[model samples]
Target: MTATAPRPETSGPPALPPLAAQVERLVALGVLDAAGLDAARVHDAVQAVDAPGLLVVDRGLVPASVLTPLLRLGDRAGFVVEDMTDVDAFAPTDGLDVPPSPVYVVTAPDRGDDLGNWSPEEALPELAARGRSPLLLTEGLHWALQVPEVVERNFCYMTIGSRLRKADGAYDARTPAVWISLGTGRDGRERRGAPKVGWCWWRNRHTWLGFASGVDRLAVPLDG
Candidate 1:
């Protein structure tokens, strides 16, 4: 009989570390997992339990269930816990209004080809002509949001609510108001788990968002 090649094993999303790590980092420290928790829920959790520090693990983007708890924890702790997801969270009630300015987009130079939906480099030239900066938003997790001062020193984009407004100040149709840069290639290597920048309210699957250095503020309207 001829030898045959063996099939490779398929896999699901990577498994996280043991639950103990979670307990030690969050439950033990008196910190709550605020990223995945909602405000009132977080308040309830805090009131129910006793701890010192909180650690919220976002398996993916920030969800309302997760954010509400963090908000409550922020109220109790006097500071917001770190957001582990690659995107930021915002209040849904807040309105989305683009000031009359130039919009800048940050993206990876190499992976832009694979991003069939959007192109940062191609989009930036016109924006720059209007005096805006096109930054390349990078990929990372919770640690990235920690250095607000550094982010502020580098990028030009701003985070806002998901709802969009028209010229008359009325609500626009509830489209997927946010856009996130998933990555640039078919292999998914360049964009997997990359942080996105967009409105906070559009937390559903279709919405996209990105995270950029705080220093590079956009001068135009970023529809995503």
Candidate 2:
């Protein structure tokens, strides 16, 4: 088998919106309402942790179950794969301490395009070696929501930092990812170009899907 060449960064990381603007985006998406969270309180919390970071709403406030369908890229809305009805079941793997707060920030996030064609099992150690952490599924969604350009044709990413732990204590092999729908299969013709929350097997690799990662996470202090 021929070895595939590594891909380059799709482009420089697109600039993220101001933290305040990002909070309002959540409001616009009805995330606040769906989460039963007050927009003002959410806004204030984000303000306290404001910095050059990607604002992410922890699954506690709004489950991936709810947020996936609310994602928008251009005229199309986001969706979870029909087979992935248990999307919320996936959680941060052991040792990946996602903040307990409802809103937090991921600093210096990147779509690891250079790691394209590498399987999730292959990429995790590389990310740790680089002193970076893999992004959670929701963090990837937050990045796309704040900067839609991160997701496009021929360039999308995986969020393998999370995995589903079965009742037997073995982790499910399906890893979550965010990408553009091809408008084929169960996606329906109209969903082409829409953002999609889906999954891939831990050992599988796709030439176009890269792993997403970040330098660190900055949690807003829980006690205000």
Candidate 3:
């Protein structure tokens, strides 16, 4: 039997860029163009927010389904696994209330590295009791877009806030996650070091996987 290494100190505030620069990064990635949005208008919407966190276009406007592919770390692009082609159908699970705004700020987002190896079943309620919310899949992507280091080796995190509802009305057991690929199995050698968007069973624990969460979410009105 092998022993797992002790967890390191949980990371401090994410290295997110300023609000205005975030918009420019989005523009450079063609996120604004894909959503038929103008850079100036998008910049104006969240200008009033002076906090340090991720600036995300609402999933309604630029669904994670559409934006995940645009995520890049170094020269490696992000991707969803083939088994999850219907990723868009995974909505915010019951009890998660994402605001109805075209844009929002994920206040004080952390990769939750301290929660690594805990199953989603164990992590979700833990987040709630702490007055935090698990980061949605899109939110995780936003973090990677802004600060790629958040998806580092041996320090990845899950996004259990989103789930797919079966026709029988029960939620699917697969919980989404973000991590770096070793380029093994179906992930080709060419994909080594790429940022991976995938899933894990809700009941399973992974030594390298944590539960990503945010202190709170604030709806940043486009009218601002």
Candidate 4:
């Protein structure tokens, strides 16, 4: 009889953007608000990124939690979270089983230059135009419960991933539940990072979160 070989075990925790680095990046981009960014907020933001797992825990769609508060703190913040059932207004044409979370739509500033020149006035409308619909507004935790599937579907379609650790010291896979502005532009489009796919687990002890593209691309001020 031939001997069978055993499968090798995967090693190490999944790779993720450093929480502090992410916060710093948000601050540098002027995304962080005056209420101030802190470690707890960073952790919460990270957890919210894993939308799917969060839904499972919370038993529904994930809310805007971290993103909403942060955006609200910023100047000239705008967003909309429309129901998937209202397909006439949203894109892709597919109906979502879950409800929608508040979408942050900020106007891009009309700075003469492209790099870090965005002002509040220019960014708001540009962001809102990307997604126009009746958005639901509520706490992050509540949002997660209302539309778990919708969150998961968006993550899948957008090719985003998430990492989560539970408070009870458990590990679970998560998918991006919310969208945000990714500074990096790619292929005439923007490149954002999330889980690769088919990798969704989480620890009961840790929180979950995910990220997605807020707008197709950074909105540059149109010339009159």
Query: What is candidate 3's lDDT per residue for 1-224, written digit by digit as tens?
Result: 12345876655435888888889988888877876777887798777886767887777777777777777778988888768887888788887878887778888787777777788898888888889999889888887887777887789989888898999999899988888888888878888888888889989889999888888788877653
- CA deviation > 4 Å runs, candidate 1: 1-32, 35-56, 59-61, 64-144, 157-224
* Global lDDT of each candidate: 0.26, 0.84, 0.82, 0.26
Model 1, span 1-224: residue lDDT tens: 11223322223112232323433434333333333333334333333322322123332334332332222111121112123232222222232222232211122211111112222323233343444332222211111332121211112132222224556976443321112233343414443323333332222211012222112322222232
The deviation in Å at residue 169 for candidate 1 is 22
lDDT tens digits by residue: candidate 4, 1-224: 11223322223122223433444544543334432434344445444343222111111222233333333212323132222222111111122122232222112111111111222123223334545211222222222222223232122121121223346854333322233323233211222222111222222110122222222211112122
lDDT of 1: 0.26
TM-score (C-alpha) between model 1 and the true structure: 0.20
Each prediction's TM-score versus the true structure = 0.20, 0.91, 0.92, 0.20
Which predicted model would earn the best lDDT? 2
Worst 10 residues of 4 by lDDT: 107-116
Candidate 3's C-alpha runs over 4 A off are: 1-5, 8-14
> Model 2 compared with the native: what TM-score?
0.91
| Residue 26 of model 3, lDDT score | 87
- Positional deviation of residue 55's Cα in model 4 after best superposition, in angstroms: 19
55, model 3: CA deviation in Å? Answer: 0.7
Q: Which ten residues in a row have the lowest lDDT in candidate 1?
A: 105-114
